[model samples]
Structure formats: C-alpha cells, structure tokens
Target: MPLSQSEVLAGLAEIVNDETGISADAVALEKSFVDDLDIDSISMMTIVVNAEDKFGVKIPDEEVKNLITVGDAVNFIVGAQG
Candidate 1:
C-alpha cells in the first residue's frame, strides 16, 4: 500500500530528528524550520539528504527550502514518486 501524507510526514519528522537532534513530535504541519524548529541551513541540507535516502528520490534545493510544513514534504515526496 502507498503511504499516506501523514505517514510520510511522520517519517520525515523521524528523519529530521535523527539528523538535527530535535524531537520528532515537535515538527508540525504549520511549523517552520527557521521560526519553529530553529533549524539552520546545514541542518536543512541534512534533512534534504536524509529525506532523499529515506524516500529514494532526489529533492532539488528549491523544493527543499520551500518545505515549510509536514504536508509540504509529504506532497513533495508523493509528487516525486508519481
């Protein structure tokens, strides 16, 4: 079965936690990496790399920076897979 958007977002939260040492639960759909998570550019890059590895797809930098929410990441992954 295909993963749901929430599931993908949850997985992304886990990946983000693994990379940034933050709590996965803290990442919400409305949360911004800069304002909410206080994530730096390097950590964001790590997120992009980890996400690519996790989803087996390359996320372009433009898309990476635009991922402001869990739903955004989920949508991106779904689109990439499609």
Candidate 2:
C-alpha cells in the first residue's frame, strides 16, 4: 500500500530528527530542509538514504536536489511508492 502524505511526512520527520537531532515536531510541509531545518548536504543525504529504506522508495540524486521543502520529499516518496 502507498503511504499517504501525512504518513510520509511523519516518517520523514522521524528520519530527519534521527539524522539532525532536530525535533520531529519542527518538520512541516512548508519548511525548507536547508533554510528552515538547517540541514546540510551530508545530513540531507543520510536522511534520504534512511527515508528510502523506511519508505521503500528510490530518490535519485538528481531528484534530491529538487526536493526543497518537506512537502516535496513527502510527495516524492508517496509518488515513488506507486
């Protein structure tokens, strides 16, 4: 079954929190990973890898660059699951 946006968001929040030590509550659809979350590129890659494993979705490096906001990542993961 494909994950819903909120499901993916919650999962991604956990992954982000695990990687960056940021509060999962801080993660929201409008937040930018870099500007809002202050996630550097290295941490972003780690989060991406973990998200792939947790969500069973493949996020290409090219696509990773395009995932600017939290919602973007969640939407990508949801779409990729299909």
Candidate 3:
C-alpha cells in the first residue's frame, strides 16, 4: 500500500529534526526547504538520502530540484510510492 501524506510528512519531519536541530512542529507543507528551513545544499542532499531510505522510493537528482517546499517532497513521495 502507498503511504499517506501524513506518514510522509511525519517521516520527513523526523529526518529533518534528526539532521537539523529544527523542531518538527515548524515543518509545514507551505514551508520552503531553503528559505524557511535554512537547509543548505549539503543538508538537502542528506535529507534526500534519508528520505529515500525511509520511504523506499527513488528520488532522482532531477526530481530533487523541483522539491522546493515540504509539500512538494510529500507529494513526490506519495506519487512515487503509489
């Protein structure tokens, strides 16, 4: 079965909180990874790697570029897993 949006969001939030000191409560769909979260390129790549392992989905380098917001990542994981 495909993962729900909440599952994806929660999983991503955990990864973010683990990798960064940011609180999980601050992670929302509308938040931007770079602007809102202050995630640099290296951190973004780390999140992607961890997300792949957690979600069991392949996030290509090309697709990663399009994932500007938390919602974008959640939607991508949902669609890819589906």
Which one is best on lDDT?
A: 3
The segments of candidate 3 whose C-alpha lies over 4 angstroms from its true place after superposition are none
Per-residue CA lDDT of model 3 for 1-82, tens digit only, reads 8889998999999999999989998989999999999999999999999999999999999999999999999999999994
Per-residue CA lDDT of model 2 for 1-82, tens digit only, reads 8878999999999999888899999999999999999999999999999999999889999999999999999999999995
- CA shift at 81, candidate 1, in angstroms? 1.5
Superposition error at 21 for model 3 (Å): 1.1
Best candidate, TM-score: 2
Q: Where does candidate 2 stray beyond 4 Å?
A: none
lDDT of 1 by residue, 1-82 (tens): 5566787788889988998888999988778888888988898898888888888777998877788766677788877863
Each prediction's whole-model lDDT (CA): 0.82, 0.94, 0.94
**Pairs in clash, predicted candidate 2:** none
RMSDs, each prediction?
A: 1.5, 0.6, 0.7
Output the better candidate (1/3) by lDDT.
Answer: 3
Which scores greater on lDDT, model 1 or model 2?
2
Residue 24 miss distance in model 2 (angstroms):
0.5
